[model samples]
Target: MATANTLERIFSVDYKSKIQPIVSLCIGGWGLENLSEPNEVTIDNSTGNIYVADSGNNCVKVFDCDGKIMFKFGDKEGKGKMYRPIGLAICRDRILISQSRNCILNYQVNGEFVSSIGKLGKGELEFINPLGLTFDESNGEVYICDYNDNRIQILSQELTYKAQFGQDNLHSPLDVKLTKEYIYILDGSNPCFHLYDYNLILHKSVISREHKLQVFIPFFFFIDNSNNILIITDYYSIAFLNSQLELIHRIPITQPNGVTVDNRGRVIVVCDGGEHHLNIF
Candidate 1:
């Protein structure tokens, strides 16, 4: 709604303490060292464990809060194995993954395959290239960013199709997350971070030319406990926005594939292109 650039911005906020790179550790630092081409990352807020979608290794690696490998999955044979795991989410005791097929596969925290959601098609209970996904624990629903389908699909905790939105302005929706009062969609094609209500009504688009930050290309974003938006972009920077969608802090970092805020309000990122697989900031 309003445009403001870094140089011309009269006021700005700093989240330097949120991303402490000096005291951070890498993926292979704790002796596990098995991740390759990791994609999305999430933390188990209740337990402080981290989950990384090891796409290249075709598995998901779980690490304790101290960065020790607890366990891993995806080396199984038959249909239970993951071919190329990308997006991941954890709810209650279930771990949801988007990979291989056009569905979101459910599993136990211990790596047992539970069930699959949707199928490969264009119909209502179907998905074509499902990418990023998140679980709304408060509602027991799953919001999946159906990449090829260009929409966000809602599924009950039972994995049943309920409703969907975002077919109008999104082309390549890469990630989706739900806050207590809003839905944040990261659309790579639209090249903007869209903010919508729980009912899926378009409210505002952040960091665009209309909002002052031109050339901003959002890749992924996370809403922290305080409801502040942390957006990682192709511009090699993380743009911080307040709950009102106003740009505050723009912290620079290497290009990162995934980002999330831990229960302690610390930032966690996965740098797929760099030497480190995981970096805590």
Candidate 2:
């Protein structure tokens, strides 16, 4: 669209056949070089579009797989409209978002406003600090991690409460990932990932002494088509682990946090690669 300052772009020449191998995600792209600080990131496999929570900028930015900026939403300081932007998720088509002050917002695939289904409350159904949101595609329910309230709330596709998962013992259930059978939680405070059945029963927990931040903000992790957990380290790298809790591989990335790998094994990570550069790997 408009000509703007473009930052660093180092796409491995070999990273072209299908989803080329990611040698290492060290530096971030220039697309985010000038972008405000970012939080979490997700990719729309159907459209090959990458979505980023530009938290510091108080908006969401979209990019293509080649790392080109498509567009961005939100305003500086997030005062006029967007405020304290936090976590994000995408369903079959729409995008779900959580902003500070207990605001839950949604947008359609075309970026049209859909509905905001949550608010601040002390009840079991409402949200205090809604940290993460993801749709359980296999079950037609959206699982939400309510940070301040310490609970995971599940809702139907239409935004009706179907079930709630979690307990006070769950420090900060940051993100919810669903496999064919159980719900995966990136327990932020414990800095570990825990699993539970769809019925809301804890199954297993894989502790990570990997890093302090990993211990805190496994902010976003997703399972691949092969069922391996691609965990975004609190620092620079991603660890691929099987269901057995053994580390299969680790790829060094930069300021890595919000991360997701799609059905095709395409990985997108959100990072302020350098001091203020937003890079997607």
Best by the lDDT measure: 1
lDDT of each: 0.71, 0.63
TM-score of each prediction: 0.85, 0.79
* Cα error of candidate 1 at position 224, Å: 1.1
- Which pairs in model 2 have colliding backbones? 7-30, 32-278, 191-215
Residue-wise C-alpha lDDT for candidate 1, range 1-281, written one tens digit per residue: 11100111112324655555533445533234566777788887668888888877778888776667788886467656786788888876888999857877789877888776777987787888888888887767888898898899988868888998888878889888766556788888757778788767998776465665443666666666344444554447667766656677666776677777665555667766555557766
Instruction: Name the runs in model 2 displaced over 4 angstroms.
Output: 1-33, 74-80, 210-217, 273-281
**RMSD of each predicted structure:** 6.2, 7.8
lDDT of the structure predicted as candidate 2 = 0.63
Candidate 1: regions farther than 4 A off = 1-14, 22-32, 206-209, 213-215, 233-235
Candidate 1 — worst ten consecutive residues by lDDT sum?
1-10
